[model samples]
Target: MRAVIFRLMGVIVLMLVGAGLVGWWFGPLPAALVACAVALVVIGVDTAAQLRVLAWLKWPRHDNIPTARGVWAEMLYRAARQLRLWETRVAHEEDKLKRFIEALQASPNGVILMDASDQIDWCNDTAAAHFGLDPKRDLRQHAVHLIRNPEFFAYMGAKRFDEPLLMRRNGSYGPLLLSVQIIPYGEGEKLLLSRDVTQVERTEAMRRDFVANVSHEIKTPLTVIAGFVESLRALEFSIEERDHILGLMQEQSDRMRHLVDDLLTLAHLEGDPHQPAEERMDMRQMVERLAADARALSAGRHRIKASADAGGLRGARTELTSAFSNLVSNAVRYTPPGGEVRITWRVLHPDYGDPYAEFSVSDTGIGIAPEHIPRLTERFYRVDRGRSRESGGTGLGLAIVKHALLRHQSELRISSQPGLGSTFSVRFPLARLDLAKPGQAAGAPDAPRADRESISA
Candidate 1:
């Protein structure tokens, strides 16, 4: 301010000096006129500088500011500095907002933002897919109008956001379950969040079924044993009759024991996280042992045969044997009298993939229907509950097989048709298989023809 005042005073002094010189040359009236004219010229120049500042203000660009002198120059320099600072702050804020949006997009759960009027302001990609919404096309659209789930629509209208709502939707594979919740935020705005709980819900349901099945399975045998004990204590019977009653009790006890063992096996399979031991397994010897066990169980009721063209495998011997034995036992149990149960181990060289060893059990039993094939490996699941019980199965055989095979990085494939036959096959990767020498095969003289049922699991 002081500099501006000094500069103005200097200009006035210069004008006065010129006016004095003119006065010295001419008269007092002429000198006064010259002073007025000089003042007008100064005003004109100042006005033009002000207009230049105004023009720059109309379309301000940091790199292209109009040059000026005196007070306007100082003002323009300060204005340009402030503008650059503001631009930097704005760019920083924009970058932060972009990063925040990207984090939401990468999130597994779904997120949505809505306005006070219940219109969708924004939603992440997961949220859009969860609700079948288009992020851009559905902007500002009513939330209820887009998501057609009755429970969800009512949930928004009620504004009772304390508890999350479990919503079921039909997915391409099966039913999908979502846990959705809304939270009140700024003013009347709301944040809708959703999580896919399909696996969680299924696991919970399976737990319930497992508990019920275990209780029932145990109770039936306990009731039988209790009845037999009461009969022996109260009723008078001959030695033969008593022996018979005691034998029945022992059978029930054995059944309960077997069930307990199977339950323990399944628990171990699920709990253990270690990979199957990388020990070489003699496939020839294993196949022979399985065939022997199946024949003993069959007791002349079924024709049992075994074949092996592979030498050995590299996995936990116990786990591999248990998994292979389950399939063979299941085949023997399900086949009727004179029916054939054939087990084989052969190398499979696919046209497009690496060679693997396949161990298959083909049985001419009352094969499973297509509907029940998928659930065959589920614990205690049965297509014919009565028949399954009569066969003296613990019902956890296939479930154990599934976990064991999975631990070995192997897969089980099932192909079966109702009444004709069923084939349960296990394919071990080349990494775990030891190929046999050419023409060196064990067990049955000739391999049984492969069964090609329509359904596979």
Candidate 2:
């Protein structure tokens, strides 16, 4: 302020000196009038410069201020410099805000920013989806009114965030679960974060059910064994009775063993992914072996026929045999006496031009319901629990088949109708089909009567 005052005084004095020099050539009266006019003109010019600077302040687009004299010029230059600093700060803050919003937009989980009163301030697409909100339309709307979940509102309203809130959205598969957490910040502003936990919850539930089923399965046999052991220990019995008890015990033990083996096989199949076998195995031989096992299991109860033309498969020999045998055994077990179970093996060329080795087992017995067909491959799933137990099935046959086929890059396809019988088919990809060996380049041999055998135990 002092510098401005000094500059103004110097300008006034300079104007006075000019006016005095001009008036010295005339009289005293003219000198006084000329000095007054000079002062007015100087004041008018300074006013005009200040007005221009004022206009620039209102709309400061020019890079530099207009040229002027005295304090008005200094004020204009200083004002433009200060405007530049303000612009820089404003730009920095705006860029930071933009990046923050973009980060929220890209986040996998949902995020919502709410003001002090729980009004929707801003939200990303994920958050919008989480709460079924429209980004633009729902701005400034109350969250509770929009989401309408009492539990969610209670969670946020309580202002106690010791644990996250769990909510189930409507119209989702098995109630699509969401875990939400609220964080309060900046004078009652809140950040609401949410994540989908439906899969995790489903897995946990499946694990619990598996443990329970396994425990029950084991307990039944253990109880039976304990009862028999007690009977043998406490009371004297004839040799026949002892032998009968022993036989029952052996059957139970074998049942348990089969269950454990199936469990182990499943564990091994699910453990790791590896390269498939390069060596080809005679699929015809494998089908014959499966047929033999199925006949033994059927024990003349069912009519069985085995036919195969497919050559070989490029996969773990044991896994392939296990899967094929399981399907054949299941057919035999489910089919009643005199029912026919036919097995066929052929190479199928789909419309996509890819060939698949198809092994299918069709049974003429009580068929599976449509609803039960999809879950037949799930562990422990059964069409009829009592019938499954009576048939000596471990209930893991289909699951093992499914997993084994997965390992071989194949798939299991099931078709069935109630009271019309079922067909369990496997389609192994061409990649896993070993065509012919170098020495046997002529191609695979024809399946004769001996290869396609039909016999009952």
> How close to the true structure is residue 203 of candidate 1, measured as C-alpha lDDT?
93
lDDT of every model, 2 decimals:
0.87, 0.83
Model 1 steric clash pairs: none
lDDT of 1 by residue, 233-346 (tens): 899999999999989888899999999999998999999877655776677677888888998999989888887764668888888888888899889888889899988888
TM-score, each model?
Answer: 0.88, 0.84
Error of 1 at 225 (Å): 2.1
- Among these predictions, the greatest TM-score belongs to 1
Model 2 error, position 277 (Å)? 5.3
Cα lDDT tens digits for candidate 2, 1-457: 8878897787789777876887788767787887788778877887898788777778886565678776777777787788889999999999999999999999989998889999999889988877789999999998889988989988877889889999989633446689999888999898989898888998999889888878877888889999999999999999999999999999889889989999999888878677546567877777788777878888888887887774677778888888988998889988889998888888665788887788899999899988888899988888899999888888889989999888877888999987779999888888877656334553467455454343222
Judge candidate 1 against the unseen true structure and give its global Cα lDDT, from 0 to 1.
0.87
Q: Candidate 1's error at 307, in angstroms?
A: 1.7
* Candidate 2 residue runs with Cα over 4 Å from true position: 1-20, 27-42, 62-89, 172-174, 273-279, 350-352, 437-457
